[model samples]
Target chain A: MKILVPVRRVPNPDIKVRLKSDGSGVDTEGVNFLVNPFDEYAIEEAVQIVEKGGGEVVLVSIGTADCEETLRAGLALGALRGWLVETDEVLDSAAIADVLAAVFKEESPDLVITGKQSVDTDNNQAAQMLAAKLDLPQACFAFKVELGDGKATVEREIDGGLDVKEISLPAIITADLRLNQPRYAALPQIMKAKRKEVKKVSLGDLGVEAKSATKILGLAQPPARAAGQIVGSVEELVDKLVNDAKVL
Target chain B: MSTLVIAESRQGDLRAATYNTIAAAKAKGGDFDILLLGSGSAAGADSLKEFGAGTVYYSEADAVAEYTAESYAKTAAALVGEKGYTAVMMGATTTGKDMIPRLGGLLGAGMVSDVIGFDGANYLRPMFAGNAIATIEVNTPVAVMTVRETAFDAAAPSGGASAVAEAAAVGDDRAKFIEYRLTESSRPDLGAASIIVSAGRGVKDAEGVKQVEALADLLGAAVGASRAVVDEGLLPNDLQVGQTGKIVAPDLYIACGISGAIQHVAGMKDSKVIVAINKDEEAPIFEVADYGLVADFAKAVPEFMEKVKALK
Candidate 1:
């Protein structure tokens, strides 16, 4: 079974966001990047699958050239290999899905895995779009999965509870944070990943290298928050809410 | 001139999203009839007559009672193909996000999610998390889009004139819901709340959440938190407001001690008024905040409360 795990390289969640004065985009200069936290679950889930099933896990991503380093990080974590579909700019969810659909056709993996949403874009569209494009079964927000003969039983998260779903092989599944606790990479694994090779798949090769129809017009920053002066006690604070804010 | 709208219904109740879809259609399509699909939702469907829905279509079955994206998409696609409706819309909830792409593919329509506004099927949505907004033009005839709850004001629940429209039986063999769990809140939702106050990792501990709760209590506002704080196990998942969490569009939002990640901002940027309180004015949250205060939050929070309390 070939398991594909596609991830996004977003700014480290631990790092504070820096917005430009015009509120157009984040200041990426001199910023550290890491695997999207949600994607970490995808990588971990894939690794666990291969570890149990004895097949290989292949990690993939469609992003700018800088993401190559991030892809290498996936290799260190335990994927057998990596694919970097290099592009000059970011692709919208649909365009990204188009590229992935073409690649999935070639690879013909038994299972496709990706983060439910990217920490950067947060559109949460890629996996379902890919499933739609490929006409494959999809189970999203997967909290757990058990693979058997040609079938996969998945537990998906819903508003109030979990739903048990059974799907055939050759399906697309997107992982959420509750899916799994990703393992931390040891130093030895980091050093070993330096030697692992990454197959750089260009957008031109995917046959859907065209620019997206969506146009980004403006970037905006979140409005400011006012500092609250702490009262002497919690009791005082509650009173303030009742008397001043009149909300209590 | 006829439009097809999908009213999101669950557990015998018509969701707030149904109204948003109607508002968008009234503003986008000159005429539209709403198609609401769910089990035990006939009364909810009948309630849509005032919202410009000329007709309401509902199908209820034991299996369809639960929200299955595949089943929802499949059923919606069937109606769309035979009826040849102008467009299909869903709320961008957990179910909608999973279901829309499938519907788009099934109906061969283009999909736009988290759209704040639209004009003739050309829609605007937040991209790069919330750092930037994109306007996408879908050439597909049956336009499929998800409207951000805050993007458009919901029209009055006058379905104008509505008749019961029959739909095919609900069949969702691809997915099934064996069980579910939820974190139901008694207070107003953050998206619907007029005032909101949220805390972040800067608060350091669960005890710190009290300050947020107090502030929210004072303002009669909802309490929210950054994903980092939620990840820290300081709050429930529902209290999280961000890209991976709940999306909000309150009239005023006060982010306390949150440095502001793009994902967090993406969820709350639609709020009419934003205020950031942090010791580091350089924090990205200040960029979007209409008001910024640089001071020790511990000190500032109390002072602000005093000023607010004095008004009483």
Candidate 2:
């Protein structure tokens, strides 16, 4: 079994991101970048599956050379190899899905796992789009997955509940929160990761075009709430909620 | 441009988010239709007609009887192709988030997910959790999108009855639905509730959670939890409100013992009114709150319940 995991490099989610003054995009000037938090769960789940059964886990990423670091981090987590679709062009989820679909045709992995949504865009669209492009079944927002005979049983996190579905092998699964706790790379593994090979390819080399179907007009800070008063007691708070806010 | 709004339903009743999505479609300024797929869709189609849709289309074939994206997306895509809809829209519910991109792929269209508002021809959506809002435009002839339910008001009935039509259902053999297990709760749904009382890590334990629940029960509000509490296993995943969890904008949001993490604030900052009670006076949750109270939740929650009870 060969499991393909796609990782993305995103601004560290701990720090609040700021918009550019010119409103073109986010200001990446001094921000730290790391593997998106949700993608870490995908990497961990893939490695665990490969560890249980004898299989290979391959990591793939689409970005500039900076993404090689992200792929290497995944390799340290136990992936056997990495592939970087290197491009500096800003692509939307649709373009990313198209590129991944092209890679899927070449890799022919038995399973594909991805983060439910990138922390930066929060679009939550790529996995489903890739599944549709490949005509493959998909289980999105999965918190529990059990591999079976040529099939995978997945428990998806849905609104107000859990939905369990069974999908065939060679399918796509998007990782949600609570999937698993990702382990940190040990010193030895980190040292070995540097030796692992990451093959770089351009979109043209993959026979895919990086075309965006959506255009960003601008970005701005969200409207801020007015400063609140510090009520001294619970009674005062309740009164303010009922009288001043009229929300009670 | 002709638009199609997908109506979501369960147990033969239309969900509240469907109304909100309809409101979003209406805000887009066009004559729109509604599509109802799956079992128990006829009743929902009938209710949807009251929203002044041009037509309410439904399908109940065995293939599309259950809510699987494989079948539903095929059916919706076919309908979009047949009618030549310029746009397809739905509420940003779990089902919508799962299926819209598939529909977009099948149609080769551009998608804008979780839209909050519209500025002329461009759509406004939050990025980096709600810290920044981006204005985007779909460049495809057929656009696919999902609107955040909390950002729009529920559409009111326009009293113009719409025509009902039956549509053919398309099938897929790739995925099979086994079962759905809903969290059993007598309280209101967190997303749809007007009042939400959320607990945080400061609540301390399961006992603390119950105290917060007691306050929620008094006010007939839904109970929410911070990601920290949910990670600690104090609450179920469904009740978590944060960047990675449910985004909710209720009329009133009360955060108890939660330090306002940016992720947590992303989910509830759009709420009409926010009240925070934390022992830490400098908790970040207070920054976005309309009212802040510095007190131990253990003492404050019970007092809140008593005070709310005295109101009735």
TM-score of the first chain alone, every candidate: 0.94, 0.98
* DockQ, all models: 0.30, 0.86
How well is each residue in B28-97 modelled by candidate 2, as lDDT tens digits?
A: 9899999998888987788777888999999888898888899889999999999999999999989999
| Residue pairs with clashing backbones, model 2 | none
What residue runs in model 1 are displaced by over 4 Å at the alpha carbon?
A9-37, A63-67, A85-91, A143-168, A200-248, B119-121, B214-220, B274-312
Which numbered prediction scores highest in TM-score against the true structure?
2
lDDT tens readout by residue for model 1, B80-184 = 887778677777766777888777766656677877776454777766666555556666677677777777787786625678866775565655555555556
Q: Tell me the docking grade of candidate 2.
A: high
> Residues A1-248, candidate 2, lDDT per residue (tens digit)?
89999999999998998788999998888998999888989999999999999799988999999999998888999999999999999898889999999888888999999899999899999899999999999999998999999999999999988989999989999998888989999989988999998989999999898688998889998888888889988888878888888877
| C-alpha lDDT of residue A160 in model 2 | 83
Q: In terms of lDDT, which candidate is strongest?
A: 2
Clashes of each: 37, 0
